[model samples]
Target: MSIRPATSLSMAQPTMEGAGVHLHRAFGFHEPRRFDPFLLFDDFRNDDPAAYANGFPWHPHRGIETITYVLSGEVSHSDSLGNTGTLGAGDVQWMTAGSGIMHQEMPKGNAQGQMHGFQLWANLPASLKMTEPRYQDVSSGDIPTVVDDDGTSVRVIIGDFWGKTGPVDGIAAEPLYLDVSVPAGLRKRLKVDTYRNTFAYVFAGAGRFTDASAPRGVLLEKEVAGQELNIRDLSGNQTLVQFGSGDEIEVQAGPDGIRFLLVAGAPIEEPVAWHGPIVMNTPAELQQAFDDLRNNRFVKSAH
Candidate 1:
């Protein structure tokens, strides 16, 4: 199997959003072509309640799908359609804002005042942009977790993995979203469809992603016992690793092991006109969406 080379590495940038909710953005608002079918990704993890308590107030979203996975604490959300729910640790909520919708998400910290989660925005193809809005809230217990013989673990969230299918289905992007943890000092290779755009976001511990095409001298190197050692090449926490074309990705865990989100999706390859949360194909269509919001006609099918 061909190992996908690490094309680029970047650290998540600290950003403030939704009434001053502090978070880190891994990728968004730029370079849409690199991650087609996926628009933005945010790592909203905070220990100070004041930093995240304000939460994402009511906002409008159109022509996109949002996937929110809670790692700690709880997120209570309500939408313009009168749908409301609370997502606890390990729970996931996938919301598709087809025509348009207004929603609000309020985060409540855990006992230790820690709130951690991720929000990914996926673009809907033009055919589905004007479809109906929908929600698929999967509880933690309902999602499947697969454990390997070598102590590696994987949580399949959106697509099939290790012969197991995720709880949420009927997604436009047909993406594979996995939460993977490798044992310390273990080297693991994971398969990914060759036609999809793939990226990994490291959130815990350290690891090294093997780039078959990179020259031996170019990677970050260190010295061990009077010998050159290429160790801990990956920056670990909040680091985004984008991969090149291939069918598999290889990662070697560091001394403390590694945990990350491996996400891949088929590209839509369509023109994107994005303004805030609303995404469309043409600028004029985006303007019409705003005009609809101003005239109280944004929600086409609120059910």
Candidate 2:
């Protein structure tokens, strides 16, 4: 099994969004082609209520899908289609803004005034960009979690993993989204499709992503058997690791263990004319989307 090397590593940048809601953006609004078929990812984890209470007011989205996974607290959301719901801890909401849709998300902290969750934006192919909008709200209980003999656990969210299938389906990208936790000091190798662009976001604890040919650096771990081997720096909370092509990824958990999100998807390989929440193939199409919003015809079908 080929081990995917770490192509790049970066820390999530602190940013403000949605009426001053403090969050960290792992990747977005820059280098669009680097992460094809995926637009943006935000870690909206906050412990201060005032920092997130204002929440995201009404916003328009088109030609894309938004996936929100809540780890703590609750998120109350509503859309222009007259759909409303509250996503509690461990809940997930996958919303496809095919034609167009206006929605609002308000976050409510838990009893401890702590709110933790992630939002991922996936780009839709040109063929399905104008399809009907839909929503798949999966509760925490419905998501499957698989455990290995070594106490490693994986929560399969959007694709088949460890012989279990995720609850959400019919996505154009057919991506694999997993929440993985490894026990302390355990080295684990996880399989990934070589055809897909893969990335891992470390959110809890620390770990080292082993790449045999990685460049030498102060972060490098000890050489094995006195042979020249390169290991990536220990990745801790809010770190993003982009992997090179391979069928598997190997990592060593630190003392406190590690918890991270491993996400991969096929590349769209098409021109991306994007502005704000709307994405299209060309500038003319992007302009037309805004014109539709002005003409009060953004929502093609409301169900």
lDDT tens digits by residue: candidate 2, 222-301: 34445654334444689899988999989888778889999999999999999999998889989999999999999999
Question: Candidate 2: which stretches are off by over 4 Å?
Answer: 215-234
> Which candidate achieves the best lDDT against the true structure?
1
In model 1, what is the error at residue 33, expressed in angstroms? 1.0
State how far residue 126 of model 2 sits from its true place (Å): 0.5
On a 0 to 1 TM-score scale, where does candidate 1 land against the true structure? 0.95
Worst 10 residues of 2 by lDDT: 215-224
Which pairs clash inside model 2?
Answer: none
- Where does model 1 exceed 4 Å of error? 215-234
